[model samples]
Target chain A: MSTRWYPIYQRGNPQLRVFLPNFWMKLVRPTEEQPPNVVTFAVSTEMTKHDVKNYLEKIYKVPVVEVRTRIALGDTKRDQTYGYITKNDDVKIAYVTMPKTEAFKFPDLFEKKAEQLEKDEKSMDDSKEGFRKFLERNKKRPGTPGWFSI
Target chain B: MSSTLMKCLSLANTLRTATLRSLLTSQQKPTLAPWGAVVPALASHVQAVSGIHTSAASLGLMEFFDDPKVWSENEVKVGRAWKPDELRIKSNKELHQLWYILLKERNMLLTMEHECNDKMEVFPNPERIDKVKISMENLETVVRERNKAYHLLETGETGERPQRLVHNCFGLRYMYKSCEHVLPPFMNIKWIKSRNVGFGGRAVRKFLLQYREKLYNEKRKAKNRSRNEVMMILRRNPDFDLEVLRRQFPQVNIDKLRNEDKARGHYVPKIGV
Candidate 1:
C-alpha cells in the first residue's frame, strides 16, 4: 500500500519517485506489415506515450525514436445460454519506433515446435517398444520384477 | 539554453496527462539503478543507459513476450516463493531490485495470459503468477517491517500513513486513511463538507435503529445457540463439570441454567453427593 502512495508534486517540492512501477508492456506481433524498426506493444491501460518511450529507453535499453499509443476497445460477446453481454478489458497498444538502422522482427516463437514434437514422438515410441519387450520377457514369470532379472 | 526552453514549452503544451508523469525525472532517474551505477541522464542516449550490468544480453521491451524456448512446452516449472525470512535478510537495495524483477515477471505473465486467452489456448503454469504475487507480497511485508523498526528507532512513530476512526453518514465507524493534500485543512472546502456529514435527521435515526437491530439480532441468535448447546451438554451428562462449562461459555449463566427445565435430563437425576 505504501509503495503505491505518491506524494503530490508541487512546483518547488521534490518530485515523487516510483521505485517499483506496476505498469506492464508486452511486445505484440504487428498485425500489418511495417518497417522492421517499428515494434508494436500492448501496454497497461494507464501507461502514457512518454512512459513507453522512457520504459524502452531506460529499462529495456532500446533506442526509441518515437512512440505512438492508442486504446483499443475490447470485444463484447453475448453468452450462448443466458444471452448476457460480456466484454474483455480494453487494452492500450503502443507503437514504439527504433532507429532506422536497428531492426527487430517478432521472432517466430514456435519455429522449432514441429521438430520438438517429432523428437518427443520418437522418445515415446522407444519407451513403448521397451515396455513391450519387458512384458514379453516376463510372460513366464509374471510376478518377477524387471530389476530382479536385469 | 534556447533548445531546453523550447523543449519545456513543448512539454507544457502537450495535455496528454501521462507525459506529465515524466515531470518528476529528477526523482525517478536514480531509482532505475543503484547509487554508484551509471546514472541515466534526462538527455542521455539509450546506449549510455545500462540499468543492470548482469543482464546486458537480455533484450529490453521484449521481456514481456514469452521465452522462445518455452513456446512449445506444455508446462513451465518454477520454484517456490521467497519466504519472508529469506527476504528479511536481504538489503534494502536488493529488495528494491527484486521488486522490479517481480514486477516485470508479473507483467510478462499477464501479457502471456492475455495472449493465450485471445488465442483460446490455456496459459501454462498459472501458479507462476500466484508465486510471483506471493513473493512480492512477502517482500513488501519485509520492507514494511524494516521501515517500521527504523522509524520506531529514529522518529518514535511507525512512519506509516496515519489513519483515524471516524463515523460515516450511516453512523458506522470506519478507519479513514489520510492522504497528502496540497491545501491545508481549512482550505479544503470539499473535505470539510464531507467530514461534517449530517446524520441527525429522522431518516438517519431510523436507519441507525434498523442497523442496530440487525446487529442485535445476530448477537441474540448466537447467545441463544450457545445457551441451547450448554443445556444439551448438561442434560446429556448430569455429572458434567460446571467449571468446564463456565469456562467454555462465559456468556451463559451455568448456575441459573442448571435449574432450568431444558437442563433437566429425561431420566431422574441419580442420587449423588
Candidate 2:
C-alpha cells in the first residue's frame, strides 16, 4: 500500500497493513486529574481511537483495555497592542485505559530545579571571585595573556 | 600380524573422525528441541552473545518520557544528527529500527516540550527534536534509495507513485500526482471533464502575458539596480579597484560605467599638472 496516498478500503480486498507507520503520539500530562488506569496522550490529530489502541498495544506493548479520544479546540487570543486574533492548532487527546494492574503517575521533573539553580548561582559567584582575583594579580603586567600567568 | 593390528587402528580412527564430523555439523545447524524451542547450540549461543541491537521495551509507558537522569538538567548534551552518508551504510533492517528509535525520540521531545509549555517552564535542548527529524528524513531517503534500486532491478521502473506535468485551468503547469480510481478514465465522467480543461482562453492569455511581463520587469529592475550601485560606488571612490567592482557585479560592465558622467567623482581632475 502507498503510504502517501492511502486508498479507500473496499470489501473483498486484502487487509491493509502499514509496514512503516509514521504516526507520532505524545504522552501528555493531563490538565485535570484522571484515574490511575487512564493515561492521557496528545496524539496526531489524524489518529482515531483504534489507531491509538493499536499504537499503544503493538508499539509500546501496553495492554490497553479501552481507548477514548477527543479533539480539543485550542484557545484563541487577541493581541493586546494590535488587536489581531490568533488561534492555536486543535489537538487530538486520547485517554487510554490500561489494565488495573498497571499504575503510573506523572513525574515531577522540575522538583529539584530550585536547588539546582541555587547551586548554579553559587558556582557562578565563585567563578566571578576567581576572575576578580586573577585580574588583580595581573594589574602589574598589562596586556598579558591569561595563560602566561598560570 | 602387525598389518592386522594397523588395520584395526585405522578403523577406530575413521570411526572417531566420523563421530567428530557429526558433532561439528550439529553445532553448525541448531536443532529445535520439543515444542519448537531452539537448542542452545553454538549458533544460538553466538546469537545470544551478539549484543542488543534495539532498545529494551520493558520501560513501558516510561518510554514516552526522557531519561530520568536528564529530567531537570539545564542543558542536555547530544550528538549531531544522523547524516545521509552515515545512514546509507546501514542495512534495511537497521535503518527501519533506527527510524522507530528516532520517531520515539521525537515523540518524547514533543511530549516534554508540550509539558514545559503548559507549565511555563523552559524545555532543555529543544533542538533535539530537529535532530531527530533530520535523522528520520535521512533514514527515509536511504530507504527510498534502496526501494528505488530494488524496484528498478525487478520491474525496470521506479515503483514510486506516478506523476505527470499537466496544465490547470489557470494556464499554470504543475505536477499532477495520479491517484487510484475504481473507474477507468473513459468511464469516469467527472474526471474526464476536469482533465479536459484547456488553457488558451482570452483572460488566461492576458494573465500569462502580464505574468511574463512582471517577471521580466523584476529581472530588468535587478540589473538596473546593480548597475546604478556600481556607478555610485565608482563615483564615491574614484580610485576603487575596477577588477574588484567587476568581480562584485559580474553582470555590470565596469569599463562602460567608468566612462559615464555619473561615475565621475565630485573633485576636479588635475589635467596636465
lDDT of 2: 0.75
Q: After superposition, how far is residue B150 of candidate 1 from its true place, in Å?
A: 3.3
Question: Scored by CA lDDT, what does every candidate get?
Answer: 0.73, 0.75
Residue B47, model 1, lDDT = 22
Top lDDT prediction, candidate number? 2
Least accurate 10 contiguous residues by lDDT in model 1 chain A? A105-114
lDDT (Cα, tens digit) per residue for candidate 1, span A4-110: 66777889878667776767777777888989999988989999898889777777778999999899999999999999999999999999889999998776555
Clashing pairs in 2: none
Candidate 2 TM-score over all chains jointly = 0.78
The C-alpha RMSD of each candidate to the native structure, in angstroms, is 14.0, 14.1
Off by over 4 Å in 1: A31-34, A74-87, A111-150, B1-57, B229-273
Clashes of each: 0, 0
